[model samples]
Target: MPETLRKTFAKWHHWIGVFCASLLAIFCLTGGLCTIGPAFDHWVSPLPPSISKVFHTPSAESVAVATEYMEQTRGEAPAFLRLPTPQDPVFRLIRYDGNAFQTILSLHPETGLPFKDKPSLETGFFIALHSTLYLNRKVIDFIGLFVSLAGLGAVISGILIHWKRLKSDFQLLRLFSPTPRRALDFHLFCTLIALPFLLTALVTGVWIESQHLVEDFSPRPVISVTETESQKNLPAHLPPEAYKELYQAGAHYWGKDNQGFFLIAPHQALLVPSDGKSISLTRPHLALTQIGVKSWNIAPSTDKNISLTAFVKGLHLMRWATGEMRWVVSLSAVLLWAALGAGSFLLLMKQRSALNRRNACPSRSDKIAFSFAESFALSAFGLLPLTLLGLLWLEWLSPKIPLSLSIHAPQGRVDAFFCVWIGLSLIGLAFSLFRWVGSFPFADKALRLLWKITLKGSVFFALALPFITLLGREWRHLPLLPNTASLLLEGHFVLFGLILFMCIRKNT
Candidate 1:
């Protein structure tokens, strides 16, 4: 409350905000992508239309055939099999290292052989990036610690700095005002709007990451095996079709109302089932829904219900939330993204103005910093979205490209992503930042021309994505609802492109 202390908090807020702004933006951007979409990212997986066209009920024989194939060929034993469900309609052989799953293969319901065992655009890639940023556990834990602490600190300091204005500016907007006032108001409004979601996400994220850190460093406790030696050493042959068999038996008795999934482990296959009413996947956990286990050696597990860990994980990830809850979680992240973007823009503008004022003094470091910021702004604003659509375009086109084009089939889509991204980064930097900083009298004419072309051309390209995606043969298996969702997402992108088009200030 004191003026001096408030000023100190204000300074802390500004500097910390500066430090976290870009990374927070990136965090939100990737998080938003990971959570949302009318069309789920997993739908674009590399399943062949031939295999995907029809649903075939999986039988014991089918599982046996698939199991035989996997046991003979796989380097590691397949941990579990997923039965034919309406959603997937094929057997999935899954293996796990720790808590992480590696889907070994999808087997044909009829032939029981592996289908196209790879997906080009893996949805898991984004999730992995969000969690670990590809760093090892210990390293990422440290980063997570820093992010959480700094985020909390930023929020607290921001509250201190804007304690009075928070309430006063809650409903204020200068949308029709001059650019400077309008931009500031927009930034403030977004900050106020997004504060609750941002704080919740940070807190939840910190809790989840901290648990991992503690678990990683903590020593394991010793366990006493009280089971009879003969029972413990019981030689059990795990039928590859065990889950399918059990599920069939359960379904026969419980009827269509009960549904669930199996969790495959080295020694036991746990059946986590749910009745539609009392317990559904919307909030079901291992303890909550785990009815029993099909063990290789030990007796079937007794019924268990509910887990605190599962609840926390579900709440943070929104994996347990169904319907409108998912929308709230996703939209909140998006709003946070917009707020971060507005705040970052304001910071960059302030820095640029400061740099311009110091132009007479000739600060090389300031120029360099400003140049980096300028280039980042251009890439994030312009090239990022274009590259995303380019990825879609390339994915659709890659199947049409003959093998002679030298895009390796396995890595082709990934290659396309980087090619578009890096290519645009290079071209954009040359035309925009490098030229603007140079003494050339042409005065970045190349940038203006390039910008105009991109903005105008991209709207048409975005509008065409739904049709192109629909035309993909692999997508023929999509149900009517999923197809509709994909189209709705495409329309969203079209609107985004139109917004870009409207940003043109003058002719090149």
Candidate 2:
């Protein structure tokens, strides 16, 4: 390839990659946390002793409470309610008028009253941010469309820039390479490691997001074409007494032990298999029943497109991934973030060296590149790590932070996360801009100190967390087995942590 073409590829990779870096960092961070966040959140959160008593309540009665509460409090009936079961005993009202993340409420099964307001846990907020970005479903789906496309461009440009080294340096990690080149090598290595995962995610992510963005994936469309004749004919509305009878029938047929695994809607009640038993998010395990129905009407989506789409979703979301494999998926996300960070760092260092050489009168592109580099630097070194440390501590410290003060707590610590990222990024950016303008001798030292402290603190905390949690009360809270999976997961964490520790060591 000509030198001009190679420089073009590098420019595309650096600029486009920087723009997506911070956003993808948020995605990966939240995705990784969501896997273990719920478990850790529950482990750290404490229930009020007064309201802590838990016991089984009939599914019908629980749904009855949720519906009544929804009607009385919100002046709108709940579209569906999750009935209480042994594993999760709270009555949850969700999906109102075919909309989610609206009017979600938890109620005591026996009393049908709201639980005391407290710090949000269970990682549902993080899950919501991951899938929907806390925006309207349609908006997020559309945003994902462009993000996936841009991701493809970034990937292609990256490949173009590294084609020469693809074979020879695929597994190469020159720890002692020149400072700027070493970061570049690590970035390339991480890119190679994460390529398969990234491609799979981009393709399937685009497909799934397009379904919702254009077709508007909703309950009506979900069932309209794919549902069976019997299912399409199933009545939606059921009387209160009929609901009770239906519950009794389900209990009898599916075993009393598995009762209440149902989502009650006015149109047709969906009784899904327990979450652990279900792999595909939108396929086979779903069953529909009407008021007088005694048999399960399993959804037979015979359409090949529907089946293929379900499999695609399973791939994109990794719903079928289990045990340490789920950790691998999460780790893939983190590695991709690390690659972006390394590339950002390499660019920043290169740009800084160039700026020092010229000392003044940089081009417009150089200025823009510096701004982007600085933003990515702040995001990579400061915002993400601080937010991670704060959230990590929150996981174990929630039970310790007395909730005696209420009504002001940010929902899910989202306010805290946002504030930290925004504030830290601005401060870091200000320092970089000031240094650029003033060309102060001490500015580099200040920036280096900030970088070292944040990176070291974040990495060390990550290294200590698992070991400490294992030895502490949080260990009892893990929804994991005392088996090889845990060992394998910790091993993966240590491996990644050590790699990061080395990167920090080299940079510092």
Candidate 3:
């Protein structure tokens, strides 16, 4: 390596790491948590009814059901019924009085009763916390953008630092090092090995968060459609059953045309002359035969909304790539946390050695302080996996619990799961503290082997996650054996842990 360039790059890497470590840590933790997002939805909602109980109606029928329910409950018709799709459990009915859009939910098929119960907080809570730390939204967005950019810098600098040793250090973890060197090795190994996932995550993170910028720059047309006498004379808000009426009208308008989904916005005119279709708040799921209304003639018939771009984006982010993929990401995150802790410890040990040499005999307080810091890091590293495992165990146990009569969803099992998981996390965290009690050193040989094995296992599981989902014949349906794939990977984890135990058994 050239002296000047090497020195310059080293300086940059060092400073950047120092500056961004805290933020990097937060991003790492959040990204890791998001690995379980897909599974979260399963817990958030009531267990779906038996497949046989679910009614598969034409899109038009969905509209009719929504409208009928609205008329009975609200005593007025809604100008809009956002089309029903498989994704949302409830259909949204919209009324545009003179000023604003009011929304109500039709609880069941042909039951326009407004959802009297409190809405589930899970969806909103995750979204709010994920984007902002529940702080100001704009500030959080800016901070997210900053974190993403910093991640970019860290990755670039990190790669440079490990450029030469990159291949050789792929399996790097010194067996018998003081803390600092060990920590460096651990850090290098993690960054070097998990580079691709981290990079993709970082880039995608920034892009996803910056969507508002595109909206700001894009051009939108002004809506200018003359309402028909019937539309003008129509009450400011249509009856609650407007959706059902619209759907029935549309069903008759387009015979046997079973478009999916609906959207209702009554305040806006039902036509956009600039675009070919009328102003429809709803759309169809069918790719080839999807219809978008450019205009709605209130005098003649009802209209179904159409637009293609929205679904494509929704599919990408939801990542319903199957349960196995979720498991892979979750496991990778677990490994990443381990790597971080292990590597950081190695680095700290190296530093401690230097301190010891400089002082010849360091004071007791300094040692205690150093020990406390190490314990904190290790706590973070250990707590995450324990928490995750607890959650999984909860999911496994949830089916046995009874349901809530007042709530639309099953409540007992999920509640129990959280309580037990959180409790176990606290307990496991206390137990893991034993690892930090000693200034003792372990033989590096087994630790080294363990790291390699875990790394390989993580990669194997990650690749396996997506492929298994894709290969399944009924990807959309529940797998007959939910436990099968996870159990195999878990067995691998147990075996890996056992192997590590044999390797480091004497050291502890």
Candidate 4:
């Protein structure tokens, strides 16, 4: 690369990384958690232990049970039935109340009795945060699309800037080297290691968003329903027996090795089977109506274009992953975020070093901009873990507090997360302003003190999380076993907190 071209790429890479670091970090952490979203749901709200053996209830029966349970409890039938699997042998009925909240009901397969009923907030929160940044769907889609594109741009520019050094950069890490060189080496090492995974994720994210945008604006085909002899003979709604027949027909058409059928419409059902030996994870479906099995929709053609698209989507989403492969993907996401963070931090540090090397004082605007950037970075990095710890603490504390002072269930807890995050960011900004306005000789010390306090506070809360949860009244209700999600989360908090503390202590 020419000197000017190299500088341009480097400049764009640094700028994009700096601008999108916080959003990308949020995406990475939430996306990692969401990769195991089902596990989280199982851990947080497992099936009743009394149901010892899995019951093989027919799909239609399960849906009927779920529908009856929902109608009895919420005075309305569920909008959709998520059929039971062997792994999670409960009929899940989803009901939207035409507002921000939605209700989810899980019923026993055999008994047709309610196992759990709650707002669809807990597991959905992570997914919503990952997909839409907890904003309006339309607005966040655009923002997410832009951020994903910028992330891809950053990755490409970074590769261009480091094209020559790419071969040698992965050789070794020099911890004892000068700060700038060491930071650069560490950043490059992580970037190179996570390059392939990061590139696939970014590219697929862009593709997914583009498809969503297109679908959002595209015109839908209008299908006119003519009153044919078959349509006239069919009843308005299929009876329960008809559901059973439809399920049998659909199952037979798809073979025994299928997931389950979902009621897509009043009289129509769509059956989905497990992934097969192809790049496409999209399952073939058997569509049924009141009459009988209407059509067998085969899987999409395995052409080069379709296969490539499917491969990219499956790779990015890991929809076909199971067991330990999900964990690998989650860890890869975390490492990719680490790479981005390191790159952004190194850029900021290099800028600070350059400023320090210049004997002349920086302009007032430059000082303000630098201070703001530092504050934003500090809050962005610190608030995520702090918010998570805050939510855990709230979970334990909410029940104990008086009704007047208590935060309500899931929604209030989510609100508390945002409150804590915003509060912490404000505090960080205040400290940054103080550091900037304070006496020259003490400014650096003040800033360092701010970071040390933030780090120590975060570590304190992270360490306190497990004990608080265990000793609280809800301990008996929570799953705290070694393999459960509670213990896994607690271990993460302690391990990551200590690592963060040690790193900060050493560097600061």
TM-score (all chains, Cα) for each model: 0.70, 0.72, 0.49, 0.78
lDDT of 4 by residue, 64-157 (tens): 5555543343333325555565545666665544333233667677666676543334456776678776676677768778888999888788
Best by TM-score: 4
Question: Per-residue alpha-carbon lDDT of model 2 for 229-319, expressed as tens digits?
Answer: 6444544444444445555655655554454344554345555443333444443334445434553444422444446677788677765
Query: Per-residue lDDT for 1-508 in model 3, tens only?
Result: 6778777776555444433443444445445445454234333222223322233443444445455544443433335444433333344554543322334343443343344422232322333334565455556667766766776776686677678887776565673465455456656655555666566666766775566445545686654555343234334344434444445554554433332334323322231111112223222221111122322234332334343333332332324333456565555544454454554444445545655585477566655555444434433433333333433333333333344542223233335434644454444334333333454234233333433443343334433433443334143244444334334444534543442233222323
Which ranges of candidate 2 are over 4 A from the true structure?
35-120, 136-142, 175-178, 215-261, 265-268, 274-281, 285-311, 407-412, 439-446, 467-496
Q: Report every candidate's CA lDDT.
A: 0.56, 0.62, 0.43, 0.62
Instruction: Give me the displacement of residue 279 in model 3, in angstroms.
Output: 23
lDDT of 4 at 431: 62
- Give the clashing residue pairs of candidate 4, or none: none
Residue 100 lDDT in model 3? Answer: 28
